[model samples]
Target: MAAENARQVEARVPPQDTEAEEAVLGAMLINPNAIPVVTDVLSRDDFWRESHAIVFDAVRGLYADNNEVDVVTVSAELERQGKLERVGGRDFVHALAEAVPAATAAGHYAEIVREHSALRALIQVGNEIAEMGYKRPDDVAQLLDRAEQRLFAVAQQRRVSDFLPIRQIVHESFDRIQSSQEGKAHEGVQTGFKDIDDLILGLFPSNLIVLAARPSMGKTSLALNIAHNVGVDQKVPTAIFSLEMSGLELGDRFLSGAARVSTHKFRNPRLLRQDEMDKLVRASAQLTEAPIFVDDSAGLTMFELRSKARRLHDKHGLGLLIIDYLQLMVGDTRAENRQQEVAGISRSLKQLARELKVPVLAVSQLNRGPEKQTGGGPRKPQLSDLRECLAGDTLVTVSSTGERVPIRDLAGETDIPVWTLHPDLRIGSRLMTNVWRTGTRPVMRLRLASGRTITATANHPFLTVAGWARVEALRERDHIAVARRTPSPAEPLDFADDEVVLPARVAEKVPDERFRHLAESDVLWDRIVAIEHAGETDVYDARVPGTHSFLADDVVSHNSGAIEQDADLVLFIHRDPTDETKKGVVDIVVAKHRNGPVGTRPLAFVEEYTQFRTMARSDDREPF
Candidate 1:
């Protein structure tokens, strides 16, 4: 009885279709064309027999290299890979070919093999889950999560997508393009910015768009704006995962933007005027009806995010997903370092986007590259500045004029001229510097109302009255580049001066040229010559004529505002010197559209509210 029981246990096997696997392999060995039909549908792991797996892997290798997949070539490949003997040599390869009735049923045979493979995988996953449960892990929740992830992995493996011919793909693509061109279909969600829409053609499904900027550069504001546009305006279901900000905070921001009420008024409802209160009530009603959902759970891991996202997608049919910022996401503990962890997170986010078939807008914080620069320029964000969030070989495709081109090439093709003021001029206790410093040659152009134009080199001191006279228009231009004073190598060091010593390192202190100049001149005490507090402005007698004065009105006094008067439209960037809570500006830049001519679109920025809005025509104009 014991021997019979053992034999019965040995005979019982996991699910598999040996005949299907043999037929599929035989078809591939007989006809090379049949390989493409099932290559995507099946893999070596799908074969239950080890020898069959080896034979299939050899055929796959040959097919991948564009080599013939006949019995002879497959046999040669298996021998080259030292797997011929393991797979019963050339006789087995020949036997596989002889087993196939016809290569026409290769796809059907491949499907049967895949079905059986999935069953085997399911059994394996169940056994693993049973083993894990038997151990009774301390963290039941974590164990359950692992079990679900394993099950999900098996389910994903079972999903087989067929390859379409180029003609079919092209026809579908043409239809989509035609619909978009005719304004009958929207290919992706609109960003609410017409200029940006023209440049990018809106955000497409399954795209992982990384929107990065320094803190307080309107990244959140822009993202919120887009979400509101899609959810409220277009009636699309949008989900936001705000790891840093609370759901209430996001709701308040949405109310502030939609109602045109200042964020300050939202926080302090008692201060809201009657008109603002009415607007707030209406905005709240509208938002309550919008298909926007917010999840403000803090410290969400990638797995948690995916699970929640999947639920939201299944229930609400999510059309768009937004991550408030990527850095705050909890990474895998097993990762070697932060970079590897972030890379893994980013890959998962991209996968989520594809699986859900929706655009994922991931907000990212730029590094302190701008502040660490020794050159006289404002630091602009670059792809490399993404901080190891993406792989080096990752390629981004942009579709324009019916042709898909690399994003790098598109940037080069759409290069625009940028200008900046002389950096030596002090602005808000710091030198005004160029943001875009590379390949920039200063060319001064002046157009008078009389249709006459004047051109000159920008070598003249831009801060001087003479330089101002040459510039008739300063529109769409912000920032200035100050020439750094080069230290003379021949100058002897003054060791006698107590303040003048060898370069010393200081903790948490950044070196600045303005401070160095003040130190050398023995005028460090004169730095605070003017103090402009809220509702009061005081100036000391020793205040410099053209230097920026300290202002406590949540504003920075800069020369760019004065320069705007001469131009038709000037780009203005404002930073709050006193408001450390936000640590950045609301409307950091207002310049020309990427694909359009130079112009300025006024956006109202309430420093106290930390919100941005389209300026009303009736609203009083303020200096930058």
Candidate 2:
């Protein structure tokens, strides 16, 4: 047993390279040039040996103060910090200086140290993940998200940049200016439209550009136009995160716009003429060659989106990112209010743009207040209008395993099958596709005779004795249907012991306060005892696709904004209703430009083709 314990201790040794750590420290101590290179990659914690870490910390301290970094200076800095005796005194520092053969290989040695440090971090993360698996958190999605984030954090350690001297920054700036003068460095990815490009300087990197407008104002059309121009015309790799539309739908629109054919005719191929069909075929072939990747998954949390974006950026060298309609995104569940959630999301998007060194174009929706103004020709959406835009604790049974889980815990789970009722009042089973966070709305809690209650929006529907009725339409004493038998999932849940969800029989055994056999039903009819307004809350609706309804609280149920400051640029799409002469002309309002002039750029909206283009005068035809 003692020998086995010894082997276990030996096996548990962390990854480290003491030789590389000493070599890097020795190089930095001897040569001044090696200090900058070493500092770029290695930090104090990156060193395996305690003595080497103390020496490196001293060297960094000297460098930070703009002092020459050498064996003498590092020793003095260590002595000043009262760490010299702890780090083997001045003799060890002199020995490190003498140990290095050359300073030119310091960067290579530093890389070795950084790599070992990264490996150590990864090992730590693995241990944390193992502990998490042992604990078995209730929300598996959040657990997975946190684990992914820990892994990403370790990977990002290598990319950490140290503070650069002003001299180095000035030299880089001068070089960039010279390159620009020589016509070698373009400002940013150019949108095909000259007018908009002139205003915003062509979507600069490390910037968050928000394109917002009311529904059907061609915001998505314009965004896709820019994406097409960058990915197809400029040959830059682009990623599109579409929360509102499916990838297939976006593909069809892209084909229609690029082919210059009417979307209506394109969707119905039979209506297309021979030339239009040829154009579409040619456009489809061209689109296949473009470097535009699309992820149309619904309700992506910020962490999931960032993880995907980082993967794409690493794999394909992403140039631009576009998100359609920000309002559909789910922020951190811990946020106390919708405004705070939006603010967090806004800051995260900006951080992502900066981290990837790419431009982020996010689509946003405006509140209805813009449209309801009394004296409006066309109510232009302002930055403030962007702010006002748009969980049930009910235990739901997993149709597959008959495990009763809270609906709120399943916010982002897209593939869990649940028992549901079709709009035709037929009982069936379907995947609880998505839990969309329809932001804060007035809710009503209805109590049933069986003591089961559900809080939902007024429009949320439930199956009744008479056809399906919404919470608002149903009166008191109305009988609602509940499933009596347990749903047999394909496989038994492995996480039955996590206390996340209890099986029907387990609920009866445990008899916890939260545990009730409300899920056990066989077409049981229960009358609504009371209906009361439960105040406003961030409610969620599950999308059970074909059935269009999910069993909530054992009853069949029907399914169903911030960031002005964090954004580098804000664009509002406005269509003038009073102007009849310029039929489809819409104004791209640059509401806020952090570093440039704010103005409106006129672009023509081709409604039939679902495209945006440069406006043409009566005498001139300018290709957008």
Candidate 3:
């Protein structure tokens, strides 16, 4: 008995040693979840999974034909394109797999990876099922056979007394809190004209949320609005982590957006009146007094957020955590790959949300995938724009583009707000509907304007649908990314997929400042070659576009909008300078127009223009 016990004990790991303890604690400092990944990757068997093969394939597809695999660089590469899915998307590939092939080890390594991965996942599941408490498979197997014989059909088979127990826990939670009718009489909380889903999904103590978006749209604006509503309006203890911007910077943007002042103009303190200053002072004072906290670490780590968040809640009884964006977070593993690093960060955030029982709002970035879709038509954003994340209990994709037709002789063009993301203009982090529609319905007509005006009579005359939906969206965003796939696959693996090779000069250009800052002639000329070389996309002409003032090194493929002075520079977009030889396309001319602070000329593009700038690089590896 002693010998057997000694052998068994020796097989297992001893208690955490001093060195191991330091490493584990350090790794989890940013995100507690990094512990699992660090521990799991200790063995090849744990690192390799059948599910990972598909991730590798998607990763390989990102590079060009002239490129060779650099084992040290692939993970960071995928993270930039937002190509790595958070859940089972591209992020998953970077997460579980670390096998790097030698330059001489030939064939489609991606395909080989996928095949092996599928097999591994199957085996892994089987192993788990086999380990479950069997209490003798003979008795259970005989019992199952007898039940099948008596029931005799798949349609009518299930265990009895499923819900008979565990009824007590439900009633216990339900026992607390006031009833709806009684609760309504007390002054707090308003339904944004929409009937409350009313399952009572409150922000319990210590919850985190991920709220994501593209650029210049309104992520912080929306976040602050919620903080105001919760901390000041509802008296909930809330905290916000602003990684890229400072607390002061956040305060300025919030005031400018909320008060309808131009962000640039508001900086000049001399321009304010006594009353105006009072309003600003009052808003700031009210916010400071509220139980709202802010963390503005420019290079924030997941460990810092968790540590700060935990301390804030524990000490102050914090209720909610708001991360401005997920990418800004650094996790424990200094994984060689950025995409994998982000996956570790994301995994930590989800766990934090669950563990704390409070909703977390993490803002995310949309990939440039929509701009890649083809044809000379406006690209509507789908949930596909959100990188790393797929679908959650709630999801919201907000895309808005408006047009003005010169108000035909000075009525100053009706700047009709049109959400181009969807014809319906609302694809949600779904709560209880297949589609979230705007426009006209007898029951609901969504009319959100430039100044945050949602045209629905709130059950409480206070908030708008825009305000209401913002909260709803955060509450429903999935803790994990969702990938859209059906049983019948559309993209069959072509044994003859294109062999990608990157240009020797080009791959080196990624980290080169000189290559990025090339003179106009050289930059423009090289870009033309890359555009022509780029595999065909549906959105734009393959020919290179002429140079522009902003981000000249980077490719400019998005639908540009410039109305009067909205752009001080004229972008003479040219297609096929060699083939068509046209001097200019439609003269992307900018004139003057104003809609409050955003008053500038409108130059909305009918189609997006793709650029390959030598200057810009993905924020994966540092410039060597």
Candidate 4:
């Protein structure tokens, strides 16, 4: 009876399987092949006993170092780590090896150990949750969020996604293709924009779509429009978690979009006329009947958002989830820095999308680096500009010339202006070409055959009288000379005949007029020449007077004003250089669409309202 009572007491303890842990360790020590099998399922923390955890860690160290694993090796490693005595010496290690019958069942033994570890984790999580509930936090929502997150962590610990056979994958792919062919291809929710839909083929389930832009670039408006289209127009359930904006503000924007009433009118209803008031009322009525839900919770954590999203999805069958800007969402509390926090948040959002089998549209902020542009029209956002986000190989467009190029080629070349293209276009058209000089300075001093040195600039000459004289000398190619600028204005610049000028006979051999003129004039020209000599040609070659002569075509063009030959997207925004008007007008550019042809679809943006719409033909007259 006493022994039976003792058994009941022992059963009340937390879940653990010491024998299974020992068996796994024993298999790993005996058979080298068994290490991988057990490692796949178990981590060091999976061992119930502290000594076993230490021994397993030692074994792992040996395996990682590509060393043999045996009783002697594990003991030596533990000793190196100063943990041999802490793990009950070499006798305990030998005992563990004796516990396993063979290494072939290591996988089975690992499974048992993992099962017990998961159960213990679940019990710990349950206790913590219960304690939190009893404590009664001020924000009941936050409490629930923490509890659900802890439970999810427990679930994830036991979840193992193993490799599947190609046959199974092939069958699934065939079914998907068959469905697409049968006109059931719209498996993902549409964003209601025809051009965007054609490019992305709609937002697929378990996908995380990040829409990033600079401040006042209309990313929030675009996100709202998509959510409205899916929830109100298509009647699909949608949820928007706005950390930056309030529910009332979001509702006001929605009413303006649906009713075609200006946001100013919605915000200041007292200023609205009778006709506008009627439109507002009707729009509000329609919106009230829609299945779209909004949560304007401030400083919301990822855990809280995920819990709320799951609840909404389970209860009302959510079709789309939108987060109003990713940066504002609170990250892991234990994260060491902002970057780490952001990475954790991003991974969590992706996992949530997969878990719920729904598309997550996350709004993100672009870095200020793109916004600091002084020359280009209005700076366009790129995938690289995403705050703390890493995007693999992206297709970018040159904003100046609307040329498409890959992002990989642009690395370490940030000062070179580039924009991201919409992923819907295949071919791009050539626009107006602009000449860009690629040297230390725009203007260079040169000496003419008359022994007269003057400063000359590329393209249009400098307006200074002396500069014009040099320009004339360059055009006339008379008494050509080249010189380096002097540090002191009072000192005369030194001219080097051989260093700067080529022989007239050699210069005359070139077909390019600009090159011929430059060479004849003895101007050290080592930059791309874009001019109309016989016809327009992008001259990438330049002759180095002192160096061995080769075909000029060998030199690549690095012109800032001209577009890259391999540009993928053209990101354009309308902002007057004078800054007279508000800046927000943007076009979604798809220079190399993965699914369709390259095209630019204009969207009307009102800076005051922070709203975007399909640009009307009448509005096309406005500068962009």
Lowest summed-lDDT stretch of 10 residues in model 1? 535-544
For model 1, residues 486-580, the per-residue Cα lDDT tens digits are: 12221211222232121222111538654354333311110111111111111110011223211111111111211111112112233334455
Candidate 2 lDDT, tens digit per residue, 1-624?
999985895598798987788889889888888888988887777887888888887787677667988877888888899999998998989888887767799999999999999998888788789889999788776788778767766877843567766866887889877987897736777887778876777888999989988888888888899999899888899999999999988988898888888777755778889988888788888889999999999998887898899888878989999998787888854543344466677778998898888999999876443464335475666664443211457777777777778877888888887877543334557787666454565567888776677887665556664455667777887767655443466232232223122234545687764334333423555678889977666666555544555677776565532377678999998886766875788989998898689998889887877788877534332122
Runs of candidate 2 exceeding 4 Å displacement: 1-11, 31-36, 57-69, 77-82, 133-136, 158-192, 202-207, 268-282, 299-303, 330-357, 373-376, 389-566, 594-597, 614-624
TM-score of 2: 0.63
- lDDT per residue as tens, model 3, 88-204: 453433323322222122223322433343454444444344444344554453344333322321111111223322444555445543443455421222211111112112333
Ranking by lDDT: 2, 4, 1, 3
Query: C-alpha displacement of 165 in model 2, angstroms?
Result: 9.0
TM values, all candidates: 0.47, 0.63, 0.36, 0.47
The candidate, 3 or 4, that scores higher on lDDT is: 4
True-vs-predicted CA distance for residue 332, candidate 2, Å = 5.1
Could you give candidate 4's per-residue lDDT for residues 1-624 as a string of tens digits? 999985885578788988888889999989989997888788877888999888987887678667999999999889898999998888988998889977899999999998899998887777788778888777776677667766765665734345655655887789888998998847679877665666666777887776656676677788898888788878899999998999998988887777667787655668888887787788788789889999999999987788888778767988999988777988744443343355567777877887777888777665453544546554544332331110112233444544444433444343333321111111111221322222221233333332433222232121111121112223443332222221222122353544324434455686776455444331232211221122111112111111111110111111121111112222322233345453444567543332335555666566554556555535431111
lDDT of all predictions, in order shown? 0.55, 0.75, 0.35, 0.59
Q: Which predicted model would earn the best lDDT?
A: 2
C-alpha lDDT of candidate 2 relative to the true structure:
0.75
**What C-alpha lDDT does candidate 1 achieve relative to the native structure?**
0.55
Task: Count the clashes in each prediction.
Answer: 13, 4, 64, 21
Query: RMSD to native for every prediction?
Result: 17.6, 12.9, 28.2, 18.8
Per-residue lDDT for 461 in model 4? 21
